[model samples]
Target: EAYAKALRGRTSDHPVALPHPDVTSQDPLSKGLGLMERMAEGFALAMDDDFNSREAIAKVLGGVREATRLLD
Candidate 1:
């Protein structure tokens, strides 16, 4: 989008394809953790070389799945 804007060409806005985070044990749905913030943090971590620690991201079984998709 930035590139197109800079070039003065048409910029199409496409919705980002992303998955939902894990739902906690206490909540049937997600009780919520600043997901957008976590996603941004996850992307930052996903970009770098090492991903040894998943403790923060993987708190439960569903979290493990979420991490798998996020990192994949």
Candidate 2:
């Protein structure tokens, strides 16, 4: 939600502005980031479904740690 809003509001003038690629563009980085976003969204939804489940929380945290490692 926040990310989608930020992307929508971005302008070419911004220092780190992304290229306004066509909708059909097969950009690998974009696709990878999109997949990550989906993974995060799924984690959020799962947490909502079972917030008190220790197993679910641990899995999501492990995923987040892995993602942080990849980013680093």
Candidate 3:
């Protein structure tokens, strides 16, 4: 809930912010980092499901697969 609320206020690019002051968009590593963060976010969202039943587990597993698709 808190996480979703926080994301609700961000621009699409906000999550891609650099970790270091010296980093720039031109850095190849930045692209990889952005993808990694997005993938991690997907996994987090999957695990954050409020449901407590079996359906929730299915949602989580689906989310995990969706997030990992970034690796392909």
Winner by lDDT? 2
| TM-score-sorted candidate list, best first | 2, 3, 1
Please report, in order, the local distance difference test score of every candidate based on alpha carbons.
Answer: 0.44, 0.57, 0.50
Q: Give the per-residue lDDT of model 3 (tens digit) for 2-26.
A: 3455567668767633442222344
Error of 3 at 26 (Å): 4.4
Best by TM-score: 2
The residue-level lDDT of candidate 3 at 57 comes to 58
Q: What is the clash count for each candidate, in the order shown?
A: 0, 0, 0
- Winner on TM-score (1 vs 3): 3
Model 2: pairs clashing at backbone N, Cα or C within 3 Å: none
Weakest 10 consecutive residues of candidate 2 by summed lDDT: 15-24
TM-score of 3: 0.35
Kindly report which residue stretches of model 3 are placed more than 4 angstroms away from their true locations once superposed.
Answer: 1-26, 50-72
